[model samples]
Target: MKLFRPATLVTLFTLAVSPARAWDYEGHRAVNQLALAALPTNFPAFVKTAEARERIAFLAGEPDRWRNITDDQALPHVNGPDHYLDLEQLEEFGLTPETVPALRYDFVAKLALARAQHPEKFTAIDPAKNKDHTRELVGFAPWAITEYCGKLRSEFSYLKAFQHYGGTADEIANAQQNILYTMGVMGHYVGDGSQPLHATKHHHGWVGENPHGYATNSSFHGWIDGGFFKKIGGVKVDAIVGKIRPAKIVGDPLKPEDLFRQMMAYFGDTEKLVAPLYQLEKEHKLTPENEHADEGKAFLETQLARGGQMLGDLWFSAWEQATEDRYLVTELKKRPAASAETK
Candidate 1:
């Protein structure tokens, strides 16, 4: 329930911005907003809950600051070399649910805690622990989808955990164990699907060191998730506003496997897309702008915006399907009470 303070915002604004962050973040913002739109109707009483309002603000505005995290040295090809165990890193992240083995050095730690596990896995974990709740917000899927989904499954187990445990609205809030955990799960997958790269195999880079040679011109990071929108024209946020679906429409109550199974397609296809996208990544980067950073910025921005839009849709689809063809809340209408009607 700790909302972001201005100081945390300032710090992130000062330090975290980067291309990869930007690409992943727009997705975060889009999905969080979609989640918030659920409140007024799904938990109609939530309208007056300060905690609910806090949740809405936290989720909705959470991603904007991620722009600060992007950096010249971040992993993936765009930021720097695929220096670490990039691909396999995800496979290992998949095992997070197994055990809490190891202390500060285990990958399971990465799966569950992200950065605290990292040594920087979930992007927000480390900062959050450090008391920067602003950056504490999950950047969604900062990694590839396969790795994230594995972790997400563990996180979302709570969607149904309430049934076994004492799942209730109050428990979801201040209750002892895992109140917000499933929501955390949602945060991660929303993040994953949002990243076109996480959803695709091209993942980091194409071929190897030679093709792009780690040059600023052709890094793999932005190439997969971002470069497309750059090549295509920018998306008009205002024009696309009408496309947003309601949260209640986007989500039904909550069931773990059912929700996870629904998004299996995004992850599965992303895995398949990896190899082909990486192979063709050379063609993805828009012309770089040594002379005009704005050109690169514009390209990156448009792509990020598109990514956000896509995240929003996927989020809505999850809820849309969850409704099971019953009345879509957004499509539902209310009638006046008989007395009011007579009046």
Candidate 2:
């Protein structure tokens, strides 16, 4: 038999020690995950989108503040974004904007668009959409299952803004829904943008009939969005927010989602931090409780800080950049044929 050399042994050692399990960090998932926390902060702004405020306040657990809206009104999400905001009538949700409501359900519309365009990718949604007639009071949805997947043909594509845009009502309809239908969907995508596993489907890579201990998607979601973030929560927020400086804008002058896109892109780094943790779990079977409760609390704090900071930057950047567009209304008005949202 050939003698095993030291380098070869080390190479095998590297692979062996490498955590066996991890999820692919697909772009869309990161956006969606970050949306959980983001949508709420963005709630105060956005005048035209009345329903957007309602959902934010609802998630923020101050539904009564939006007194006129009810859980039943929220259910129209099933009908689709346009129908929910356009046809339905909402009152208290819009009072603060101190302006005439313009059916601006960008958050709802964007999600509807995301779901319609790519059902497979957008299925990961806030767990709160379901729950058997009782909305569980929480800041965000639970991981694993959500209303995102169950819906049909609801995804939005921003293809129309492209010059070559063509196709039947179906084609144009889908594309327009993305930017037009919902802008805050930025929150959703920004959230997903941060998860390393969402960047890859290996999302919990093969471990031969056993998942690494201390990990579930909920665990992962919890890690980045929930717990891990708690660790350097104070610090991560500062870091990401700190990164928000004036950069030479690079994107389409007509419809520049570049800022938002870049925010999502930055999340690619989150995967780097999570990979090792998952690898450790796979090889050692580190139960979440063993590693999670106390010691992991620090992990949670740090990761969350990382995620929160990233999240904060994405939100602020998008809002700041979009607001910078002196022609937002003019640009929107230019799309005269484009329909307005309601409720």
Model 2 segments more than 4 A misplaced: 1-54, 57-184, 207-261, 280-288, 291-295, 323-343
Give the TM-scores of the predictions, in the order they appear. 0.38, 0.34
What number of backbone clashes does candidate 1 have, counting pairs of residues 3 or more apart or in separate chains? 20
Off by over 4 Å in 1: 1-22, 37-40, 43-185, 208-218, 223-239, 246-260, 271-343
Q: After superposition, how far is residue 309 of candidate 1 from its true place, in Å?
A: 9.1
Local distance difference test, candidate 2: 0.31
lDDT of 2 by residue, 273-328 (tens): 45565665544323344544344433433443344344444333333333222233
- lDDT of candidate 1 vs native? 0.36
**Least accurate 10 contiguous residues by lDDT in model 2:** 136-145
